[model samples]
Target: MLYPATKVTLIAEHFLVERVCALIEACGGHGYTLTPVGGKGLHHLHATSDRATLVEGFDHQQVEVITTDRAKAERIAERALKELFTNHSGVVYLESIEVCRRERF
Candidate 1:
């Protein structure tokens, strides 16, 4: 049987990664995957298709959390948005997903 769940993804500057992870755990997220990522966003100083023209050293991190329910997922996203994104460069969103082994999550 498939178990319903929510995937919360947060992409933010590397500096705020630890704080965000702490918030996720506090909000009942069992675990998450953190990865180094790079991209251009609406707030970017230069949003261009030319990869070569992209600025250097603008490090970012992608945090993904799969929760057993939507409530927990929303809680995490909302807290991050209100507390962290006020003066930070980041994005948080949610996606509905199914897990084969719910216990693992």
Candidate 2:
């Protein structure tokens, strides 16, 4: 099996996960996967508390998108920054990756 694709990683305030996904879709990305995350930023801790004894819902989230086209990856990054970064804590990066099924991407 062979896989060929590019991966983009986006880290942002958890609250913006939905918005980021929307931007990715608008930019022609097929879809994205999200995972809850916790870390410290310049001014504050992203997650450090318990809500009613349960881990305070995720304060950060990491979003990843796999694409076959570089342009689509760039578009997704740009939109996520424009629509989310200014007012929230976030970072976006791109990396080359190999996937087994080119058609799936």
Candidate 3:
């Protein structure tokens, strides 16, 4: 069986992942996943390139949360945009998705 849900994607600096997770959990989110990523943004921060190794990866992280409620996901995104994006370098968006085990969410 499939259930509708919202998938929130947040790409932020590595240091801000914790705070992002906290915000999600505080707003009735069940869980999330974090994957370390590296790239150059508008700031041109090439933390990891051919010249650098895994140890040099510290510029970016991708955090994803799957929530059964769309409003909850948007709330988190809005909170992040208002509180974090103004000062911190990050982007947040939401995608519609379907989950197999609805109860797990």
Candidate 4:
């Protein structure tokens, strides 16, 4: 059987993984999937010349949480943006989805 749900996705600096995971759990997300990801965006192009060194590639993480409650999903996304994304390079988005195994979420 398919169950309706919401998927919240957060992509941010690798160092923020722990905090992000904690936030997810605190916001009623029972579980999540984490993966190391790499990409180039405005943050890369705007690197300041003052920095003596530059670290590139795979410096970001992708955190995904699927839950049956849309409010819980929105809460996760909103909190992440307000509490975490300010002054940080990150993005949070939510999508409607269907899960085959509802209990797993």
Candidate 5:
């Protein structure tokens, strides 16, 4: 069986995980997976510079969604950018993927 899949990767401040998931669902993605991340970026410094200890835990969260169609992935990216990108520290990217199972997506 051939599977159609698109990987949507979102890197944003930890607090927006739920909101980004909601945007993914709203754009017709069935589900997603999230992993905690720690990195440096322009926003990371400006926001956490004052808290020396807590800054170590101040990491971005990444959400990945596999969708069955390319359009769905594009929609998810667009909606996320509009709804959450502004005034937030993050980036969203989409990549084409091929898989063996059709139902999983």
Candidate 6:
């Protein structure tokens, strides 16, 4: 059997990773994932030719958390947006998913 859960995804600036992960933990999230990513958007671009030259603060980054508690998921997103996104560019959203080994969430 599987249980329904909310998958919270946050795509934010590189520098705010510490804040985002801390918020997830403080909000009762058991586990989360962080990946260092870069791409071309209206935001800063990581040049393909020279990987090391990618802009520091303006590049792409992602943070995600999965939990059965909707309120906790929402709180993590809310805190990140309110504290981090007003002065920077980022987006946070949630998706519904069925997770196995439900207690792990």
Per-candidate TM-scores read 0.85, 0.79, 0.83, 0.84, 0.82, 0.78
* Sort order, lDDT high to low: 1, 4, 3, 5, 6, 2
Question: lDDT tens string, model 6, 1-105?
Answer: 989999999887777777778888888999888876664452433325453555453466688899999888889888887887777767789999989998999
Alpha-carbon lDDT of model 6: 0.78
Error of 2 at 32 (Å): 1.2
Output the better candidate (4/6) by TM-score: 4
Candidate 1 lDDT tens digits, 1-105: 899988999998887899999999898789999887777772354457866544554478899999887888899999999998877878888999899889877
Model 4 misplaced regions, further than 4 Å: 42-56
Candidate no. 2 TM-score: 0.79
| lDDT per model vs. reference | 0.84, 0.77, 0.80, 0.84, 0.80, 0.78
Across 23-100, the per-residue lDDT of candidate 3 in tens digits comes to 888888899898877656512343335545544665678989998988888998999888777777787788999999
- Model 3 scores a TM of 0.83
Error at 78, model 4, angstroms: 0.2
User: What C-alpha lDDT, on a 0 to 100 scale, does residue 88 get in candidate 5?
Assistant: 77
Clashing pairs in 5: none
Compared with the true structure, what per-residue lDDT tens digits does model 5 show for residues 8-94?
999888778889988988787778898887655625435544455445774678899998789888888888888888777788898
Quote the positional error of residue 4 for candidate 6 in Å.
0.2
Residue by residue across 30-70, what tens digits does model 4's lDDT show?
Answer: 89999887665525434555432333556688999999999
At residue 79, what lDDT does model 6 achieve? Answer: 86
Tell how far residue 102 is off in model 3, in angstroms.
Answer: 0.8
**Which candidate, 2 or 3, would have the higher TM-score against the true structure?**
3
* Candidate 3 vs 4: which has more lDDT: 4
lDDT of 2 by residue, 1-105 (tens): 766678999987766788888888888888788888755551143433544433444567889999989888988888777877877778889999998777777
Model 3 lDDT on a 0 to 1 scale: 0.80
